[model samples]
Each structure stands twice: as structure tokens, then as C-alpha cells.
Target: MSTDAVLVRVRALWEGLAAVPVSFSSATGVSVVVSPRALICPPGWMGVVALQGEAIVTAPSSGAAVAIRAAVARLSADGLVDPDLLGRALPLAEVLGPAALAYVDGDGFRPVSAGSLAVERLAVEDSELRQLLMVAGDQDAAESGLDEITSPAFVIRDGGKVIAAAGYRVWPSRTAHLCVLTAPDRRGQGLARVAGSAAVAHALEGGLLAQWRARASESRRVALALGFRELGAQLSVRLS
Candidate 1:
């Protein structure tokens, strides 16, 4: 898809998630709106998604939205979604993200080269999936989103032990939100890229847009290797 078409689809997804109409453009700036029903964050939280050259923000009230708009007025699209920068700019009790938002269309996906390792497609309920998560530990497991995947998992094993896996959950706008995790001890061996390739390929073959949100540098590198393009960022905040 062309960049313009990709932007349109991304905007539509956020509009639905925020439960509010959002306008995105090549025009540079941030636009904020109040939406208590916003799905971008839990109730009573504020959310911002920046893409292309603009940002769409959702806050708890008109007053709060206005304050966010002013605070981010002089910031660039990338800066608008940086959690640390936003924390400094606004009165916040907590900041939750600044995850890099990436996407890949069917044409852009680059599957990793075939190696000796084979990917096994397994049901989400497979005990191996849970085992992989347990070994990954709390923080890594939560960040991977593996526990929430909706599709079959593409798993990799080492000597009969599950070591890595990847999958996706269908989101609004036919988007496939990806989840990839590698056993901490099995990382740096390209296992993530291999597992992620299967998941991305499956999502694309199913005609869904593949979306990867990353905070870790290793995860970002894997996404880039799979031909995903980093187009924006998303941040969630709780105001004091």
C-alpha cells in the first residue's frame, strides 16, 4: 500500500479505539479531544497517538484536552508521543508508554531466511505457550503480549523445551497486533526474527495489516528486519 493509504487505515484504527473522530494529515501539529470512552487507555486516563505529521489526543475532559494541546503545540510528531517528554510537559501521576508504532503490508514483509530451525503452528491453548511465558518472566512476558494472542502461535523449541513464540490478536480495522517473545536465554540467536516471520506472514496472508508496537531496542530491530516501517508512536498517561 502507498504511504497515504497506510496512514488512512492507521487513522481509522485510532478513531475507533478513541471512540472519537480524529483527523490525521501531513500538516504538522497535535489535535486533542475529550473522550471518556476512549479505548486507547483505561477509563480516566489520557492517550495520544502520533502519526505522519500529526497527532490525535484523547483526554478525560475539555479542560484537560486543551491543556495537552497547548503543551504539545510546539512539539514535533515524534516528540508529541514521547512519554518522558510528555511527562515533563504535563502534570502527570504516571506515564505508560511511548511505544514505537510500526506496520507492514503484504508487499513489504520480508520473511527471514530459512534455517535448520522449524516453526511449529500450535493452538493458543497449547501448554507450551504458557511455559514460554513463564520462563520469559513477568515484565518480558507482559511486554510481549503473548498471553493475549488470539491466533495460533508459531513456536520454536530447543531440545524439547519451548524457547520462543509469536502470534497476533485481531484488533479493530482488520489490524493484527503482533506478540513475540523469546526465552531470555534463547535471545540473540535470531529466534525472535524466525518466529515473528511466521506470525507476520500468517497475518498478511489472512489479509490483515500487521502492526508491531515496540519499546525494546531488540524488539524494534526484529520488526525492522521483518520489513515493518516505524511510522509513529503511542503514549498513555494518568494525570494527577
Candidate 2:
């Protein structure tokens, strides 16, 4: 579970999600492939994943792939995944992401400082955890992806109410895609770090590569605190 090993697994995951054969390389600058079956994207959506000094553009059509490949030449390998820049440079009607994509192995994980806060392992479908997500509202709930986790949740409660939770969905290649949530009123209190740390520890014990995709700075900070290294970014675009 060295840094290099994690990156290799991540690259394979992305390539499989691309739905078409594609070779990503730092030497190639950017590689585009046409795949209507792009599993990482919604139907008709296109995606770009940049990692380890390489980039891959997955488009539903060759025409769109050609256009994106052309525009990305003017963009840096890292910038290829920036939604704002991609939206402007391409014929994008809507965009998602520019989110940080990170991963960690057992060696890199930093356990949480639980202190007085109690962390518990609960079912991913726990009723209390669902209530916590409802209180967090729609946008935050969706961002957390807590409802989609396949692993048990690591939760923190306050005054008998669940305030924060973290877990992961098993993705292809035995990757654990992390999902973490903190109550709106309970953020900035390190609850996320503690819950997320527990989840990471569980994933590592299960021999899964822990992955964290963070859009908010606070979320990114929590991931970093848990020793996840931000390797790249991901963007999904709907063509006009």
C-alpha cells in the first residue's frame, strides 16, 4: 500500500469507468476516448479525470471527444479537470466538480484524536443516521453520499443525537469511496475528522484503498488531516 501502488489501482479504476480502452500517460499530455457507455458519467454526460500527471477525457461521441481534446491542449494537465475552465472552453450546458480526488493507504492514515467525543460503529442504514441526513438538508446530504455507503458508518453523537457520520461505498477494484457528513450546526468542531478517521481505519483493515472526493474546503481539510493525499480532480459536463 505504498503511494505508487495506490495510484496504480486508481488509474485502473478510472480506466474501467471510462467504458472504452484508453491509455493515460504524463507523456501524452491528454488522452481522449469516445464512449457512450462511460460508466462514470450519467447517460449523455461526458467526464474528465486527471491523476498522477495524466488525464483522460471520456465523451459520448467522437465529435465531442475531438472538441474536448483540442480545447484541453490549451489547459494544463491539472486544469483539465477544472469544471469552470472546461465549461467555458467547451460547449458545456452544465458542469459538475473540480472536486479534489484523494486516496490513502494504511501507512498514510492518521487516526483521529477522539478526546471526549465518543465514536460508534453503526449500520449504514441506521434510522438515526438517516435522520441526521434529513436535518442536513438536500444539497449537503447529497454531497455527503452517506445514503449510498456500503460499509458501516462511523458516527459521533451529541446530546443523544447523531451529529456526524462517515462511511464508504465499495467501488470497482476494491476501492472504498468515502462518504462523510457533519450536522450543519455541528461543523468546525472536528466531528468529521473523528468519524472519517474511524471509517478510514475500517477500510484499511478490509484491505480497500480509501478514496475521498471533496468539494468544500472544510471537507478537503478533514481528508488531509486523515492523511489522504489529494492526487487530482474530476469534472463531469453536459454538452449543449
Candidate 3:
């Protein structure tokens, strides 16, 4: 199928799956689906496929086709893909099937202190933060349609540079997904917890529930710290 056709099919599948309670996010038009204990993606894509138990996929409308096998490997590592379903999706070997691997499961959300971090709402004029997000991972935050809304962003700054960031992607249901990112050099400093709390508080202020798909351990930690409860796990697969 043409790339456009493939994109349409993949997005359709994502929409269908997201209708469930599982956590999911999309960046640059690519979708990342997270179950309670795992992460998954479509057949072809690339970039920070997984982060702190979360997953990211890339499906650019104009780039060369991504490796289906690599994409499956990323998803399978978290046990997000179903081998049986994957086999049916791609009848051809070149098309690749979902890969499977074992992963560790842990905490979800717990309570956190809102006063520990400096929180600020983001605006379109905040180009520096936007730039920081765009390069933090394989996904580009600036282009993620996040800036188009009045969604608030909470950030942690060290000196003049942003050390960490968190924000929400509000959906039509008055629910908002929590997205957090910390600079590689700034991790291990409790920045995630601080920024995450700010994001959660913002969601609560807006009367929206904060949600995210996390890796087993990270999920547990964030959920426990943020007062998020476990929903359930999800299994996803892509056909060739």
C-alpha cells in the first residue's frame, strides 16, 4: 500500500484501540500505545520507542519507510505486541511481525509535593522551552500539536536553562494525558517527580484526570507518587 494508505490504516487502528482505557500518545503524527505494564507501536517507525516505560513511534508522511522489524523489537521488549496477531498482519517475511520480550513491572502513581518544584504555564511565545522539548527525544515536542492548545506546561530550570519539562495533552473527554521529559544530563535529580507533580496539579485544577502509559516500574512510581491508580494492561500488534 502507499504510505498515505498505510498511515491511514495505522491511525485508524490506533483510534480503535485508544477507545479502550489504555494509555496512548502520538508525536509528529506517530502514535505510541502504552498498556499498564508495556508499550507498543505500529509496524514501521523509529525514535525513542520507549521511555521510562512510555513508547514513541514516528510515521512521517514523506520519509522513507521505517523498519518494521526494529519497530516490533522496541514494542516486543515491553511485551506490548502479540505474536499471533503480528503474524497475521504480515504474511510476507519482509513485512516483519511483532517481536516479544519480557519486561519488569512495578509501581504506578503515588503522592508528590507540589511546592518542591517551580511550575510555570507555557505559551506559544516560549520558544526556548519549545526548542528544548523538540530535541529531548526522538519525538519533536514543538510539532506535536501541543502548542496549539491552552494546555499548561510545568518546567524546572537550572540557572537559565530548562532542566526538565512536563505538560498535558487534553482530549475531548476532559481527560488529559501526562507527558514528562527530563534532559539526559539532568536526570537522577528528582526533576521528573517535581515536574510531574506540577503537571498533575494543573490537570486537577482544570478538572481533568491525569493519565499516562508507563513502564512497569516507572509507571508504578509515577502513579503512586501522583495518586494515579492502575487501570489495566494492554497488548498491541501491527500487521505487515
Residue-level lDDT tens digits of model 2 in 47-142: 888896788888888888788778887887777777666666787788888788999999999998889988998897789999999999999999
Report each candidate's C-alpha RMSD, comma-separated, in the order given: 1.6, 1.4, 12.0
Backbone clashes in model 3: 21
lDDT measured at residue 150 in model 2 versus the true structure, 0 to 100 = 92
lDDT of 3 by residue, 33-104 (tens): 333222233334321232224433333212222344344454432333344543443333332223211111
Cand. 1 TM to true fold: 0.95
Quantify how close model 1 is to the true structure by its C-alpha RMSD in Å: 1.6
Best by lDDT: 2
Question: What is candidate 2's local distance difference test score?
Answer: 0.88
Q: Report the number of the highest-TM-score candidate.
A: 2
Off by over 4 Å in 1: 26-28
- lDDT tens digits, residue span 87-198, model 1: 6778889777888899999888999964999799888888888898898899999999998999999998888888999999999999999999999987999999999999
Per-model TM-score on C-alpha atoms: 0.95, 0.95, 0.52
User: Candidate 2, TM-score vs. the true structure?
Assistant: 0.95
Candidate numbers, best TM-score first, in rank order: 2, 1, 3
What clash count goes with each model?
0, 0, 21
